[model samples]
Target: MGRLHSLRPAMTSTDLIVPDPVFRRVPAAFGLRWWMAGWRSFMQAPLPWLGLAVALLVLLWLLAELPMGGLLSQWLSLPLLAFGVIFAALLRKRAEQARAMTPQGMPVEPQNEGTLSSTTQRWTGRIGPLLLVSLLVLALGGVIGAVIVMGLGAMFGLGLASFGAFAKVMTPGVGMAAGLGALAGSLMTLLLLVLLALYLFSVAFWFVNTLVALGGVSPWNAVKLSVRAGFTNLAPITLFTVLLLPISIVAMLPFGLGLLVLFPVLSGASFASYHDVFGDEAAA
Candidate 1:
């Protein structure tokens, strides 16, 4: 429930890389912990997540109440929201888990399998706080993201309209020339804007991961760190973005059922990446 952090600086070139202990080790780059993190996160506090998801889906369903709204309208949003929530939760959890895995002065062991009563207590104990924290952050973030996407959509529509107006008054001989020129110009501008926004968002995403990993920070500070880290590690982070973009698109092919698996793996990898980069302070 608390933010985790490292008192020491990141590992330097002279720092040694030691093998991870068996329980701490991740296999195949991403592992079960990542997947489990997502699954467990949902299991830990499903009602609130489900409520948020259902509310979002219902909003979408109402908006789509027109003729075009079909089974896909009523149901598709539910799954999509679920998929996105699970993915985000996994990322958050992996970041936490990665922090816990850090070899701090206090060595920590994985929680052992126990009876249902004790396990239930362990799970529910943090569920309340975790749900409160995750819901607040996610709600605010979701609203901001939705606003950006909607604003972009409006801008694109306006640009198209402006081009139509320009085409309406052009000379016949010059019309073709001007229309093509306008279309090309508008398209290029839109593309540039989208790319720039995406770059900034990715950076912000990384900062959030960092803050979540490093305990005790507020959401605003997390955003600041993510922005800084994104700028500092632009190269590899961009490389990661390029590599993952296609995979993310492909995962969306099956109407997002593939996300059940893909979400967890990527979530785990994000956590693993954090672990690899900054030694987790939560391990203790």
Candidate 2:
């Protein structure tokens, strides 16, 4: 009883101190390692991981069946799915910690029968904050997207207006050249805006879910920290994004069924990447 009591404080104390995230400069190949690590973690408890993934898929499918379901799924299902995967990763991480503490020859203690129920309760309790953070991120992304669209619209309008003014005074060949130049400029502007939006959306909330799940950090603080960490490690992050693009497309190709495996693997990879970049101070 005394030994058990002594261990309890150590477990609880880890959760109390929220350390500032640390960014690391990893090799481009580290992205592949992160994906592999995710696969190993999923294999550690495949059934439970798959069950969670399937539940999320079902929930998303049901949401998609509703009116304007595509948007609804984005707004509602994304946060819920994120919460579930992060929570599962947290549980797996905790289990890993517990096993590490067990003696080499001795068997680890069995998990309590109430563990699943308790975890579910805890997940439900914390979901409000997760959902709030998700919505806030979405709102921020929307604002940035709108600003980009409006700016592009203004640029395109200006280009067209200038082309119109010049066309009246110019020969037919000169007018054609001016119109093509304007068209090319407008297309470039649109592409640049699209890339900018993707970059902002990716970095803004990359680590928010993990921080919230594992560190118990507030949503706002998590966002601030995530953005800072993301920018600090932009090269590695860009590599990761580039590498993940094809895997993501492949995951969607199989009637979206590949997501059953790829989704959890991606979640695991995110968790692994978070650990690598930020260091697991809370787990330490």
Candidate 3:
């Protein structure tokens, strides 16, 4: 009874996090590894992974019904993300068991469960910090949106002015050229803004959970470090999000069926990414 009970968290942040964590820059192509690891982890225990994904989806759905459910759900996602990391760790341990052999050619038993039991407690203990991080990230999103909107509006305004208003802009020659130029410029500006936000999300916000959960970082520090890490490894971050854009659309196409896999795979990816960026001494 005692041993079985110990399979979950005691809910302590200080005890679970690594002290003074270090981060390494990964190649642009390393994004492939993060997704690959996530995919592999999902395949390792498909049923349980899907079950967890279903639960998370339901939980978020329920949360969305509340007065400020969207905000609440954002805060809640961090701890849940940590749980995803724990599941990923479990999958890793299982893989280790299957491949590890003793000198006698017998499968060797793992000495202990690695980071599986304590991860839940770790993040729960840091819920306050996680909420703060959520707020911070959301606030940044708002600022980014506002700036992009202004830039776009200005762009369209200039186009209209140059073409001598709506009717003139639609005219056959000079107006048409001006209108097209303005349209192209507006589009280019919008694309740049979108990429900027994506860079931050991929480089900065995505890792906030692992930074706080596994690295034991404070909210402010985690944000700072995440942004810095993202900037240093912009290539991989850019590539990962570009590919993820389509996968995300596909995940949504099937009446959200893909979420059952997508959510869990994301958690695994988060786990894999954190370790890859910080797990190795080379990152140091």
Best by the TM-score measure: 2
Which candidate ranks first by lDDT, i.e. highest? Answer: 3
Candidate 3: lDDT over CA atoms?
0.69
Candidate models: Cα lDDT each: 0.48, 0.68, 0.69
**Any runs in candidate 3 off by more than 4 Å, and if so which?**
1-19, 97-119, 165-181, 184-188, 280-284
TM for every model, in the order presented, reads 0.47, 0.78, 0.76
Alpha-carbon runs more than 4 Å astray in model 2: 1-28, 67-71, 87-119
Candidate 1: minimum summed lDDT over ten consecutive residues — where?
18-27
lDDT of 3 by residue, 176-219 (tens): 77677777777787788777766666566767777766565777
Q: Write the per-residue lDDT of candidate 2 for residues 1-284, one digit (tens) a residue.
A: 00111101111334666455556666667777777877876666667677778988898889899999987888776466555445445555555656778889886543434434544655565566677777777788788889888987898788888888888888999888988887787789779878977886787677787666655566788788888877776766677788777988998898978788877787777767776775645323
Model 3: weakest 10-residue lDDT segment is 1-10
lDDT of 1 by residue, 1-284 (tens): 24433222223358565232111222332333334444554444444445444555466757687666653353333223323333343334444555578787864333322222332333333333333334444555568768877987898788778877877898776876887787788779878877887676655555343233222234454455555655655555565666667767886899864544554444334544444333344211
